[model samples]
Target: MTFPTIPPMHRDLDFNGPLSDERAARLIHSLGPLKGHHVVDLGCGWAELLLRTLATEPEATGFGIDLGEENIRHGRAGAEARGLADQVELEVGDAGAWKGEASDVVFNVGATHVWGGDPVVHTENALTALADLTRPGGRVLFGECFWKRPPTAEEITAMAVIPRDQYRPMPDLVDFALSHGFRLYSLSEATVDEWDTFENGNAWGLEDWIRDNPDSPDFDEVVRLTDAHRRLRLYGRDVLGFAYLTLLRV
Candidate 1:
């Protein structure tokens, strides 16, 4: 079946994840002094946080790489709008293979697949990459999904057909990071309200489109897909959790 072309996620979302402005501010503040430091964001969709970091630290330069051309363009536009175009490089490239000077701050939020691994090993692979990319004493902001609680069989099936084994518990997530040669600095989980906003933002574009284009060819299919997505998200919202870990490279 042909799917409707919906609005882009960046238009509605800021960080492309369940991140609130308050939490984002705290995370940026936790990075300490970034003066004269280089920051890198891998698989950065629109690089909103990266731009924010650069905006906060005028002396810091940033490099953001993502595979999505549209996202890169959006990021570049944001940089220009924020008067940060000269200090940051927002480009479309293979983040996993891109190498550069070790950075003082590295971000791999919600994009572990950039490092190439199976679901079970994705976090580990991303940690390894982050360790290599970050200088000693640098901070890495890692965001990923974890199981808030064990899901029932029906709930698991409703969660986009994803298997329960795809994510570990929160404790295991911390242990996994520590095992990869890092010291945990701070950890926080996305609140239910944040999750609700993110999920709703994900669908609002399509919902608006469906409402405005009732006579369009893809209107019915768009509505159907959006409804299915809402149902699945509701089922998984309580069971799935997203964690943000700030780790110092050892």
Candidate 2:
């Protein structure tokens, strides 16, 4: 099945945007041997994290897959700009249906949530699909939504982007990984610094877009979500959080 494509213009196109590379690096490094190894980044987007990996590990080669043609083109162009074109590549395809040789790591950041709102199904599909691409002892880097302390009423409303009952806690997902032949290697919560930064950066000018242009369901949803996010920032700081997980294939 063909997945919908999200262009760079319509999508968030910033590196680390609000995430700190200095912080995420330690988590990334824990999945070592990336150098001189092939790695596939699922839902690659603009390839910011992949670019960072390419820069850090001189011997590493990268394959970045996304549903968007523009993201692929832009990513390829970025690789060229970095003088790492030969070591980096891109493809447009659905992550669940994609099949290939096992790469060193099947990685994603802020992508697990973009699977059309069904995280359980989406995660299973990813696991089944990615299993084909992961050699024994390989790993998958998942950076996704997580509960901090407890969900507040406002946080529940904001997270209504997905069903409240369907909400899967971070540890729950880690359990899912362990059950499906993937072992949890590391887990870390997103601190206030990263969460606040990402939320604020992504929320910039969102209200203006909604007010100025009333006809965009595409952009309107983005604006609505951003508005709710701003509410959380103003009201529910301690109750909301995002975390990154690293899972190793058994």
Candidate 3:
């Protein structure tokens, strides 16, 4: 199906860091055998994880859904380049509402807004939605941000632009999963270095684009993204933390 082209400014503004290739590999490997299984990735940017998993598990078939047509285009190309286009499908759609057959493994990384704008509701609804998409005993991997430590009122105020309520301490997340009847199979937190790499990678991409298209009208917007990236890097390093939790339906 055809999807609307994302505006340059909107695309630049949505530049959140993604998991590194190495980390994606590790996370995929941790999900156990995938041969002949069906996998789905909601909000699958570039479909890196989905495509990587398909490459390793030759017999597996999968779908990668995201709202960005550009991302889906790139992802479709990546799958074809890997000779996986026949097995993996990439589409531009809403991750929250795209219904498919029950999958063996489902993933939603750093895109909780698919469920709702509120973090708490996002966490709850996203989990429920993923569970609905998974077959009995299937696994799900959810990546989200959390408060690294208690933040002072001023610190919270400084980061007020972000929805603070969406993040809770690590313990609360684990407890939430347990309450939902999912067995926490594995949890991986991003190291300082990994976080740095992701954030810097986004900034570098924007910088490179700006350099290549100096005459483009979007230059100012790209510069604004760079400035915001700088603030996120400087202010969010210690306060914001990210983790990938692998949960099995019990």
Candidate 4:
């Protein structure tokens, strides 16, 4: 699965963006006994899932791959600082390639949706890659976003966001897995409280980011989107994203 061309995007302001290690733990609770296993965290932005796996599984090793070098650098540095240099490897590679030989379980905390808001076509390549790496009966954990219900015309027009059909619905992500020879394991819905909390708190480190790099090209866009998120969450919570966490097994 070749990763498609990525549009200009930035995770620099991701203070509360998407899934955290704390939240991911709850979603992946049933993965059970990672002893002597190999895991790949696809679209491993920041390497949260990989870092957590290495922390918990002393005998297991984890791999993190992403197209963004900045995210990879952060992941590598974190792993090194945690003394997980040996058990964790953060490489700059395409998530769509299943270069690794064997994997017991593969997971992505939150990168699934951002790569492509839709679950079927754009995300299929990532799923194929994960499945290829996993052993028979292996699991794939996808932590992504989706609507609580279909989008309303007014909602999209107001937010200036993509339409619901443009993104794969939550139910479709599961169907995509099954069609690819994978079976459903579990699906965890991120609550309204969860979405609101993360969406609102993403401004945590943004002020410092601005002070440090005010002249950067993406600085303004980052600020703009962040501000937009704050307003939308506070005022328009029901119209947009109600993300979730789900897992599948090959």
Best by TM-score: 1
lDDT of 4: 0.64
Task: Enumerate residue pairs that collide in model 1.
Answer: none
Task: Residues 167-231, candidate 3: write the lDDT tens digits.
Answer: 78999977786677688989988888777766656565566676787787777776776776677
User: For model 3, what is the C-alpha lDDT against the true structure?
Assistant: 0.78
* Stretches > 4 Å off in candidate 2: 1-13, 16-18, 113-117, 150-154, 205-236
lDDT of 2 at 38: 82
| Tens-digit lDDT track of model 1 for 18-71 | 999999999998788999999999999999999999999899999999998889
Which 10 consecutive positions of candidate 2 have the poorest summed lDDT? 1-10
For residue 2, give model 4's deviation from the true position in Å: 26
Kindly provide the TM-score of model 1 when superposed on the true structure, using C-alpha atoms.
Answer: 0.92
After superposing candidate 1 on the true structure, give the runs of residues whose Cα lies further than 4 Å from its correct spot.
Answer: 1-4, 212-225
Candidate no. 3 TM-score: 0.86
TM-score of each: 0.92, 0.78, 0.86, 0.75
* lDDT scores in order: 0.89, 0.68, 0.78, 0.64
lDDT at residue 146 of model 1 (Cα atoms)? 92
* 35 Cα displacement, candidate 3 (Å): 1.7
Question: What RMSD, rounded to one decimal, does every model reach?
Answer: 1.9, 4.4, 4.2, 5.6
